[model samples]
Target chain A: MKRLKKVGLIAVVCLSLVACQGGVPKEALELSPESLQQRQTQTRRFDTNNEAKLLTSGAQVLQDLGFTVEDSETKLGMIAASKDRDATETGQVVGAILLAILTKQAQAIDDKQKISVSLITRPISAKETLVRVTFQRVVWNTRGQVSKTEPLDDPKLYQDFFAKLSESVFLTANEI
Target chain B: MTNTVKKTACAALVVLLLAGCQTDSRDQVLATSESQVALRSIQSRVFDTTDKAKTQRTIIATLQDLGFVIDKADATLGTVSATKLNGYAMRMTVSVRDHGTKQTLVRASAQYNQTAIEDPLPYQQFFTALEKAMFLTAHDAD
Candidate 1:
């Protein structure tokens, strides 16, 4: 009887181990730095002139919206500023610009939003030569109206915003 | 026959199995699979059409409708080109490569903007849309 119980326990443990491993897929594994670098070497560069033109077009689309251009600059990348109220309202303007240019969905602007964005280089230890763009967008709502701002620390959101603004400004500058 | 001994043996077995499964190129295999699937989906749907001019029109129109300003739309070297709207300096290029057979490779790439140095979200979306468009076009039924 004791041997039977021991065998039963062993079988149970083995079944549990098999279950755990079966759930993990071989394709989901992460890669090492060396291999990642190897892949990066094959990365191709897209056309810069065409990229610049796209940014310019995006800037024009923003102007067509209701927001007035408070400030606009296009150098290497691009930055355009338009204000409606305080920081929050300005965020909505940015959000509205993003929505208009991105999804074509009209989103209301609020007055309590705060956002900040920054771009920097990788800290040396890792793989290929890559640039990092960071953004922070905060939104507040009261009485059915909402406001937003940029410069948030969210990498994903920041990346999207950076791409849109960059392409728009780049293309716009080239057009002129 | 103690519980500790059984558990230890099981743990050791698990470790050995895991160790055996490890490979230097495992990551590469997975990455290649994901990229291949993405590439295949894009190639299959975007360039599967017979009307080259109509394909170009659809691509430009869809991009423009998505708030991307058309910088230049040209059909050359079996490719279609367009730029983004207003302030984001992103561009999309669609290329069709014919290698003798009826198979075509449609590659759509959007810019990876570094200027603003603040955000890259817009450019990523632009790229995603380009890829998605290509995939949709290639996979469309005849």
Candidate 2:
């Protein structure tokens, strides 16, 4: 019983220390060697200097993808948008139900997520404009607590968006 | 041993009971343990450029390169804010202003998981990355 008490006391102190385990991660602001590769994945160049029109098309593409243009600055060639969507999957829901049945405890499944994106256009020169977009998301569980926060780094997602953006740029150019 | 156990139990109970009445919460708003001058020296850098727009764009590009999603940007104000979510949320803001006739001052501040980052190491690393993008050396600003 004395040993149990001592172990419990140590556990409490350890829990307190664990609660304080936050400092800025050393690599959080440091540029990793993959910086150039990540930049290439997030950026694309277009052969246009009509930056204002290009930004407009970028916003349109975001809207087409179910995002609300929360803010924009044509002078800076930037657009900020976000969308909230259901995050539940049938497989996870079924698994959660089975677990609840076995343990008689409620399991929190991912309830919803908000995806935010930033689209920026840099006019490298009069002939070339670099359009870069970055995406991140926050997922909340049914218990109303954050479950995940991550950046969207999928290359296919970027490729699809750029394909749509190219079509939007062409359509906007022709007033279609 | 019994006395010590009793004391520990009492202390744990007190902590559990007092968790809801944290006095630190009141001071969290606009609270910093570091002095203004010290934080200024840590977070600000100067570069030999007076073009505010280009400076802001470079900041944006650097932030994007670092896996941050640009949150907001203004050319006239020369400010950019970005957020990076990699299982944790970190938000950063960078501002540019003409420091003098021949130099521009850039300042950056960041918050990680809702806690302000006051350490100089992160700021130094950030400036190093910014230097790479700007192709100009970063000189600490007073």
**Evaluated with TM-score, which candidate comes out highest?**
2
lDDT of 2 by residue, B1-142 (tens): 6879877876776566446334578777777768989998899999999888888888988898888988788788888999999989999999999897999999999999967888899899999999989999999875
In model 1, which runs have C-alpha deviations exceeding 4 angstroms?
A1-176, B2-4, B16-21, B25-43, B46-96, B99-104, B107-142
lDDT of each: 0.40, 0.85
**Candidate 2: CAPRI quality band:** medium
Question: What lDDT does candidate 1 reach at residue B113?
Answer: 29
Best by lDDT: 2
Residue by residue across B34-117, what tens digits does model 1's lDDT show?
Answer: 355544443333345454544454454345434333334335555554443222234456555552354444456544222111
Q: State the lDDT of candidate 2 residue by residue for A1-176, as single tens digits.
A: 88667757766765665463268888888888887777787778888888887898899889899999887778778999999999998999999999999999999999999999999988887877888889999999999999999988887888788888889898322110
Superposition TM-score, candidate 2 onto the true structure: 0.89
lDDT score of residue B20 within candidate 1? 55
